[model samples]
Target: MEAGGWAAAYARLCREGGAEPQQSVVQQLRARAGAGLDLAARSLSRDTCGALGRLLRDAAPFPALALADCMLGDDGAKLLLHGLCSNTTVKSLDLKGNNLQAVGAEALGKLLQQNKSIQSLVLEWNSLGVWEEGFSLFCQGLSANRSLQRLDLRNNQINHEGAGELAAALKGNSSLQELDLRWNNVGLLGGRALLNCLHSNRTLRRLELAGNNVPSDILKAVEQAMDHNQDRQSILAENQSRTHVLSKEVLSLKEEKAKQFLNLMDTIDRQREEITRSSRQSSARVGQLQEALAERHSIVNSLKAKLQMAEAALALSEQKVHDLGELLSTAKQEQATMAERQAKDLQQQKQEAADREMKLLRDLSAANEKNLLLRNQVDELERRGKAQQDQLFQLKQDLTTTVADLRLRAVQAEERLDMEKRRFKQGLDDVESLRQKEVDHMTQHMEASERSMQERMQRLEAVRIGLEETGAESGQSCSACGTRPGGGGVNQSPEPGQAGGATAAGAPGGEATADDAVTRGGPGPLLAAEAGSRGGAGQGQPAEPAGGESSAAGGGAAAGPEQQGAGEGGRGEQGTRGAAGAGWAPAGRADSSGRAAGENCSPGAADESAVQQPPRGPAGQGGGDGRSPGEATDQGSRDLPDEGGGGTARQLPSERHSGLRAGVPAGHPQPQEVTRPRHLSLRRCYRTG
Candidate 1:
């Protein structure tokens, strides 16, 4: 059949399918007829194959075509594929057993890249895998083809390299579901490659590697991988169908919700209209009530004004009546109570006067006894104080004598130092004179030795000249004479002046050591004697106070019987100023000036006078001393030195009072009235002092 017959068949197919014949298809067919090309013939020339490709390009009526065993080489395949590159109607293409090589395979790969309609491709029995380059290109195209699903490359001499390419293609190709690579040269390695690709390719459901030299284990693994892909494909299809049903349900639910929303909006609109009507009615009612309220407010204000006037008049009359009645009753009650109170006061006054007279008599007797006792204590204290003054004067005289002795010794030490300095200077001058004399002697000796050495050298020179005139035998004698002069000069050289220098240096060092010894030994005894005397004076000053306290205690014991009556009075007096007295004790010892000591002791006399006064009430007590106990305590505390300076003198109120009262006779009766006031006053005094 020629292109004319092919055109007739294409028209018949289009008519049967209820579609008009495309103009481009008809034109291509007419061209083939003119070229005398037959597309339906068993063996296609390159031109026929090209004509068929052009026909397929534009709305060709054929959906499936088989041109197996047609001997279409690489050129024919390229032409056919180039025309089919843009064709959409052809869904299946068969070029099996066409002797297509690498070039043809590349052309087919390119066609797959551009063609979207070709779903099944068969190139079995073709030498597509003769070169890996063409097969790689084909794999690339296969990866990109989305419409192609089933591929047959069976018996195409595909080795492990080709198989690897195909496996790579399968990894990326999602549309391909079945691949037949049976009766090829895919060995164990290719089989392994195919197995690995199955992990990534989910759409591939079938792979055939039969008749290839694949290991049994590899073939089994490949089978398992194919089965997994098939299961995945089935699952994907089922899921897709479920998704479609769910999407439809979601659309129906959305429409139902939209209808419900519209109904709710309509209901809200009706409620809003009703609410608006009710608000208008309520606003009118509020206006009416406001007018009525304004009328009632005016009437109530007029009534309030009349009631206020009436209430004011009634309140004024009632207040006046109540006040007059209260005044009359108070006046009557005051007259009766005044008479009874006057009688009671007269009786109470008489009793109080009698009690006061008795108390005064008793107080006067006790005060008289206390005053006598205090007078005696004052006399004793004055005598003891005079004795202490004598002792202090004696200590002052001793201190003065010791100070004079120290000054005299210091003067004597100065005189001795002057003598020692004179001696040291004289010795240094003598050593210097001796050193000069030695230096002169050494210089004179050196000059003499130099003169002798010059004379010897002249003699040797004369001998050498004489020997030279005599003969070679005389030369040895002259050499010996020359050596003698040099040896004599070396031996006769004066002992170096270093000896004189050593004497000069050693003499000065000895002088310095002697001077240091004189200075160190000179004032040492004088300073020690002065320090010892001062230390003795310091030791003696403190001992005087200790001795005075001991003596005072002894006197108090010796006069116990005679001063028994005065012990209570003395204790009261001591307690009154114990802190003041203790603070002044150190000041007295350190005074050096008698005026300061007297000034500090004067307060003791004042304290004794205060003790002689009769015990009085709180008011009279302040008047007696012209100052309170608290004021006295504060003054004493101010006078007291810090602990670091005062030593034991810095005592708390209780400790100071206890120490001062320790001299009181143990068997003496301490009257409560005398001791209580004195103890309290002692505490107050020490607390501040």
Candidate 2:
């Protein structure tokens, strides 16, 4: 079947794609170059394996093939790997960008373990979501394949866990010098794991993770690790230098020791004095030993020097690589910042462009709208450019002021809130002062009330005493019955202005006038004196006990002139005030002045004053009106006597209640001010010695 099958295999190869080898025939020619055959970049989106690989296997197999980005995926890759395993071809392979998930990876991994020809592999962009398990399997393949030097799985989504597994593989894999898994969505944690692997893995020189959200702190840590890496390199150099110096010193010492041994041999011969004959022999032996020492020293030194040079070059290369890695990371960070800034600008520009269009649409009519739109587009572009220029300047100023003001406000608010809290606490601490204020106000009110009540009582007492004395003095002179006043039956009555006499209770045809309502006693002393001269009996209090006449006199005494006098005086004054306020001041004597005032006078002022503290008694009674004829006398006897009364009944907790009712201090609506200063002025905190 070799010759016949070859013909058939060649037929499929040509019919499918190998017929046109004009453009990329180098791949086909390489497959038939005798040393080895190869065909790559087949770009066969369909199944090109049976056509190509079968033909190659029939004639000769390739030692290398790179089918990168050829869309082989799992099925195609598996078929090729299985066929190639039997073919004894394909030393180096590149299956990059084939959508080879776990299926293709498994086939390739198995083939790699068994196949010895393959030394390098690039499986970049293979969709291996197999994760850590997939990496482990790949590592297993690497362990089995002794010839493999480089393996690239770059741009694969193998995360931190997978990276860790790869790191462990790199530790044992001595042959692989380059392993790139760059841009594989190796997030910060994954990137860190890979970087850690680099520390102990001397063979791996290149690693990359250009796009990732690596934290600044984590990057700093990596930088520190890098610095440690550099330190380790320096320590290694020093150690090598010390070794070199030790080697040189050892060589010289060995030479010196050899010379000493020869001299010792010579000295022994001379001490014997018999080896004079063997001196040339000793010299020749010494010469041979010297030559051997020189050769050994030269060889050892040459090897040491070469090793040192290699080490130095390796160190230099590693330094450069390290520098490049750092630069790459820095560049990546800078690039990300620049991209973000640019994105913001682009968004703003787009918005500006949209606004400009809207304005043009508003300005133009439908007929010319289209033409206007084009002009608007150009104008918008120009506007955007100008705005962009202005944006930088405006943003600089706004940001400066905004940041400064915000910082100042925050600090000032903090200070103000703190001060307010302290003040509130101090106010709360002064509770005793508040209580004392309430007590003092209560005391002042009580003292003033007591003085007013006492003055009224004293006047009433004097009137009563006068009534009793007059009863004693009258003693039944000019007798008439003790009849009720205004009864129209008895004809007994006092003369006009008579102070000592009293009208009987039932005096004939004598009616109480409006003025008589307030007359509880005789006329006042001054008015009575004037009246007494006009009448007789002389209005005076007498000290005697008598009969009917005396009883009538007793009535006058009880009516103690001053009582009527006080009530009349109050009424007269009230009338006077009412008259004055009503502009009735002495009719024609400067009456015009009074007339003007009456217009401006306040009405009901006289009534207001006359109505005593609580309000005057109602027309018939006192209690209902909350005031009595005298000092709020209670008709129902609800009031206590106006005596000590348990020393004012502990100031009537109700009075305190009344005072509090005036205004109880509750939580206040505080007006708070927050100040923000442009500058923060902190005083130096000095420590007193």
Compare the candidates by TM-score and give the number of the best one.
1
The local lDDT score (0 to 100) that residue 303 gets in candidate 1 is 82
Question: lDDT per residue, candidate 2, 1-689, as tens digits?
Answer: 33334445555565676453232434355334544433345566334554555554532545677688777767767767776665555667888888888777677668767766667788887766455555568667765666666787777777767766766766666556556666666677766776676667554444444554555665565556556655666677799999999999999999999999999999887877866667868998998999999899989988998999999999999999999999999999999999999999999999999999888777766648777888899899999989997998899999999999999999999999999989887765664465355446535644563454345434534543444343322323212323222211111222223332222111122221111111111211111111111111223322121211222312211121111101110111122222111101110111111111111112212111010113222111111212213433323112221111110101121111111000001232211111111121010000100
Clashing residue pairs for model 1 = 637-689
| Per-model TM-score versus the true fold | 0.36, 0.29
Candidate 1 lDDT over residue span 573-665, tens digit each: 222221111111110021111011111122122111011112122211111211223322312232343211121112222212211111111
Task: Quote model 2's TM-score.
Answer: 0.29
RMSD of each: 48.7, 40.3
Predicted structure with the largest lDDT when compared to the true one: 1
Give each model's whole-structure lDDT: 0.53, 0.46
Worst 10 residues of 2 by lDDT: 680-689
Model 1 quality (TM-score): 0.36
